[model samples]
Target chain A: MRSPHPLRARPIVIGVAEACLRCVVCCAVETHFCHVQFEEGFDERYTYVYHCLSAPDPASNPGIWLCTACHKCEEACPYETSPLRFIEAAKAEAYKRGLAPRLLTGIIAQITSTGYLFPITPSTMRRRAELGLKPLTTEAAEELRQIALKTGLAEPRGEP
Target chain B: MRRYAFFPGCFIRVRLPHLEALSRRILGELGVKLVDVENFTCCPEAVSLSVDKMSWRVMAARNLSLAEELGLDILTLCNGCLYTLRTVNQELKGDEELRGRVNDALSIIDREFRGLIEVRHFAEILIENLEKLKAHVERPLEGLRIACHTGCHILSPPEIMGFDDPYDPVILDELVEALGAEAVDYDLKTLCCGWTLSTYGSREASERLLASKLNSMRRGGATAIAVICPQCFHQFDVGQASAARRLGVEYRLPVFYYLELLALAMGFSLDEVGYRYHRVRNREVERALEVAG
Candidate 1:
């Protein structure tokens, strides 16, 4: 599916991760936009993530793949720091460190290979026709293929 | 009537074309003409951010440039597409350095990032023309209780999306009520659908997130779920079946693209709105249509 831009997208703003979202109550993790938080009981992981962020490379924290990029924590943060930017930067940094999960690299590979997230099968095209929609084609697909090659996507470090 | 360069994102155009068909019909009814732009690509997708930010902007600008060339703003159906395209458009329009770099990358393809056009999400457009939209409601949905999932990308990081209130949204609810259906209030009303994680992260987490949302909707007395984004629709529709099998709870909540609901209100039958394509069918929706229509 879709992946984030960068854990820290330097283009948008470098050092986004530097703005530590130290919620006075560590509520971002507790109020995380997922069921997994409640399922695993994350009141304590808030402390763990706080300590984890204090580490040398906070992006190396395992399970960056799980962030939905919802940015609700950023909305709810009392510290007024953008927690979404921190998570995004951490995710990108993980990729640069080559520790990106298979999914990130795999999706880029799919896009570079097919100019789409999923390879459009004949059946998919037939389905569009069945719905009386236009064929899903774009001339810029060659451009996407070229840009992926020229820019050199972040290489995967190892299994996610 | 206004016109926009239509950017039907890959997910709906390929996987769920019914939404596209219904959206185009409904948008036309609301007095907007969607001009098809052939060269537009993936909103390169928001997730592409994790892999490469530079490429994400370049590709997004490439898609925007095609619409800009035609002198029309871009209209998108999916919120992810709105996120990628609108953010890139807003970023490129204000920043000269980033635009320079992205233009350099685009030079290879003979495309330039002029950043002239605005990117629009359908909810805002439909909401803007609510009066016209109201006139088209041939069959008012009285019995249906819709739990509206506005989805994140359509309204978040408010400065960029610039649509509804990111934290507490009511446009979908207003639209639902405009159609005479009850928009039920739920606890997880504005939570992420967790489809992104389910795709490449943790299926268990995604399924759990979905179940909680479904359970919340059920408690709110929701008979069906309404979504504006294709990803949310898939999660609520197909994800219901997956969560049911694993969690062993039949959260039989049928999902509708908000536009599909609009189409139904415009007196299109369930078959005409493609309800059969929904993964989890609810008799309440069908019964509401039969008894009320």
Candidate 2:
């Protein structure tokens, strides 16, 4: 998330084959959380996404959706290439191809639809009243719609 | 008085208003004024990148510009918001081309990415005024040993976040100790709360991860778990109940969103901070409440 690293972080741009195989033995995300904690049949192995990226289709690894983008991989990478860059890149491609997890896609769609991840209903307002706070309102649609269009996440809604 | 555009990230703003309430009351009492800006959306959380990295950065820039327009530094209560806002602000400010591209997108909405202001996590601001905070402590949590979970976004890729030492963090612990509570050392302190996995990947896996974290805290003799992130708060508090229902196990460790703990120490009673809303309650804090009654 520091400057310059994100642009330079693309897996193919930085050469993932070079980053993942030899240098990234310390796949901290996997080593730290994934080994046995993952659900059944989910590959509990480390660098699962790296291996998936090396394979023909990059985003095939279920692990891609699993990364919180916490950047543990960025810290662990010996080359400082940020294995996270590759995961995110692959995730974008996966999303573009309609391969991202449904739950995650629903979440993104929720944002694109209302700008808020969760519904800002009367209940939320009632709860806020109890706290002596305000109702949160945003013109998120038009703004997010424009970005979604530019980023290829959605089509124009025929608005001016 | 320290002034900030309080960007109470969506999870807290929408679902957990009590956390918002406590944050506002505590910061206000401490002489920090929180300004709520208009038209601010969700911080867009972890999916910011994979959903479409460009839009992620663009959305984050839009939020930062809202604060920049006001010429105030943005303060975040949740790590997810901090991750998106702070990281994107720093990245765009430092990169000409990136800022230009984001600005190009902003042009669509009649805005610009000027990067005129800064972004920060609330804890950073609080930690800076340690002596003032120490003096405000009216109810010292003498025997309440706490396991501090800073959550992953506030740490990691030290160059990016730059808030605390990622590997050996002492800021949150120092915060706890300053409030007169023990910051208990436990295993897997730096591990992700698996909130991401629970939401986007595997519930069973996150539960297992939660089990291990709870086991570690119990072993470390913790009385409560203090989290600065809402996601981690939900996972530890709500996730504990869900995990118990599914796994036939109960680890009823109370979860406090650091600000609540701060309020308690600052002489605001538990009820004032909405302790009743916490899915899990601290028995020790409750016992003290009954004694006071």
Candidate 3:
């Protein structure tokens, strides 16, 4: 979403009020919320706890707090705002400064290196076929290279 | 003689062949030729948004590239595909700097994305060709009340979707009305069905969102709902059953992809529209057919 007025971009910061909202929505599970605890001292301190929602699991369990960027919270909010976007921006900043999880970083590397998320292993193909499904993609892997060329986003690795 | 590249997206061929077949039939009835761009990868909408921003743009651009090869605007039936392609097109169109950065990062694929082709939702096409749509209706869907669910992708993003009034869009509604059925106005018509989010998280949230949507439609006196997204169709139709079971409420609402309803009104059969694939049994549609007959 390009801002018509890019110069009008104010940094999306999490204020004390926003943090308070995040805290209210936070459950005892330490899922997705602001970790900054308001200390009794003059300075704010960061509290550390494993946000259990970030743990890896099979994709089926429904209760996990994997934020899917659907922007529903943004729409559903009584305040008409989103805490998740702010958190995402902060995470992006952290990653820019090299402070994100190794697993996440590794996954990014794999996707960037290979044109797939999980490897398109034979087992995965067989599993898909078992479901009476064919690959949904219209472009084959080789044709994908040609498409990449046309888009000018990338050239096939061997091509000049 | 006009042919636009058809992007069936994930839901059409794989999950809902009914919509694909119906769309093809309906479009053919309207004299619009749809050319399939086969072998297209998953839009990667679920994985890319959280994983890496560049791949999301690049992957969508790849699809757009295929469409551009045909030298026609990309006509998308799936709202997710529309949103995904529109997002990439918007990024490349509005921000040359971002386009260059994404293109450079995706250099391994031997591709560069140029925002050349027009990315249009099927709703948009109907809006553009409303006269043709109206003329194609052989059997008017009389007495049926259709509530249009445009979903989030085609609306929102004021910059990307500059064509429609995001908050109060009426293109789909107008198209629905053109088919000789009264397009019933309903509350929460623009609300997200929360399906994209459903792929990774709680089924509860998606159900809750569906309940909210159905509640709005029921309150508004809609007999049926018209959907453009397959995921939205799955959620509103299939998800409604589960939602009713979980929430302990009866939701008799029948959901149809616009193409299916349009094709039906154009004198096509329920089987032709792939009615058997739907989770929700549509007795009201049968009732409407009897009334029209």
Candidate 4:
């Protein structure tokens, strides 16, 4: 059975030992990487809380990764380590192994294809118009296209 | 005596009309006419690219194309919009195949992107027109403690934006000095407010970032923090309270777009330029009005 999380489709690897330690302690998400297996006082309820920096269980089905490059951990750590970086590295590994979320992948594909977050269409104009917006024209459009073509960005919508 | 096409970006017209008012007031005093190039749209925001780079660039390129039509260099006040315009301009200018592809995309919008116009942040214009700026300072912002917050999008990947010293920039400070305010020097001036990421998630992280900035400003003896980006202004002004709550400290640092402060020094009024839009309530602006008066 496939893992339910999109990150599960990818292979999450911990390449750097330093990164691994930071992730275990600082990340808000409990990646379950702790040696206190027999400890009875650990609060599982508060494990995911932003304030609690305790290490989590690393064996019980590994753990969930949730670091969003906020740099809070980096600022808090006495060692000046960046847990956010490790989380990103793990996410990249997961993505490489096809474990990354399909939704994120779709968004990335759309961005790479359209050079925009939203689909550009007349509907966009209609929505803006509804909002009482005037979608003004860009006079430099042709010149910018020439620059893009010369630079090898994606081809503008219409050109021989 | 030089003129360029002005793209005020969206925030200037709505959230921070002071930027529009101040820039025009000061620049007009300096004998520079900023032409609002007709038929221009949003420089679009960088957030769109984080969602989709292709459509962002294509649409952004469309805006830049408008500037090229009139054969004028682009002068922008909003840093986010400037970055968006310049990023697309750099991408298309540097890559031939990509330019062709984007141009092809532009054909659909009925625009032909030739990519000749040079995109510049307003700071660059100050750097280029330093002497002229000094000449127009009726009351240079002297004795005022002004800290600068240069947003991340303004300076990064150093090689591309050769406009100013990314690591140790003094253009804004110097401009502030020229306007009669003492540009309060401080550390962490180059740090990002994490405005882009913070608005989405990282609320705690974002607050922490702003807290750090406030601490720096306080340490630097800043009466107020001056910014070029509307987002930076929003983060530093509006986000300061939330950040203070997170850090468990009281931080009442005032933040203003550099233009607003410049307008104040240039003898504009609180009501004339709309000082009410600021997130943080301020008295330094009023003080400047008194000083100028």
The runs of at least 3 residues in candidate 2 whose Cα sits more than 4 Å from the true structure, single-residue gaps closed, are: A1-14, A22-25, A28-37, A41-55, A156-160, B288-293
Model 4: residues >4 Å from true position, as ranges?
Answer: A1-160, B241-249
TM per model? 0.90, 0.90, 0.72, 0.67
The weakest ten consecutive residues by lDDT in model 2 chain A span A28-37
Query: Candidate 1 lDDT, tens digit per residue, A1-160?
Result: 6454433335433343355455524333433443335334355445423443454555666644556666665576565555455556777777776777666677777776666777788988897899888777645567788887667663335565
**Residues B1-293 of candidate 3: C-alpha lDDT, one tens digit per residue:** 36888877655655565566667777887888888777455554533334335556777777677677677788888777777788788778889888887677556565567778888877777878887787778888888887888776666455666556655768777878887888877766666666644554457766766777788888888888888888889888878888889999987888889888788778887776677767777686678865775
DockQ of each candidate, alpha-carbon based: 0.46, 0.48, 0.11, 0.07
Candidate 4: true interface contacts recovered: 0.01
RMSD vs true structure, all candidates: 4.3, 4.9, 9.5, 9.7
Preferred candidate (DockQ higher): 1 or 4 = 1
lDDT of 3 by residue, A42-122 (tens): 121222111312213211112212443434334334454554454444444334334444544544443334434344556
Question: How do the residues B220-291 of candidate 1 rate in per-residue lDDT, one tens digit apiece?
Answer: 999998888998899888888888999999888888899888888888888999888888997857888777
Model 3 docking tier (incorrect/acceptable/medium/high):
incorrect
Candidate 1 has a DockQ of 0.46
Model 3, C-alpha of B58: deviation from truth (Å): 1.7
**Error of model 2, residue A65, in angstroms:** 0.5
Predicted structure 4: clash tally: 83
Q: Please give the distance, in angstroms, between residue B255's alpha carbon in candidate 2 and its true position after superposition.
A: 0.7
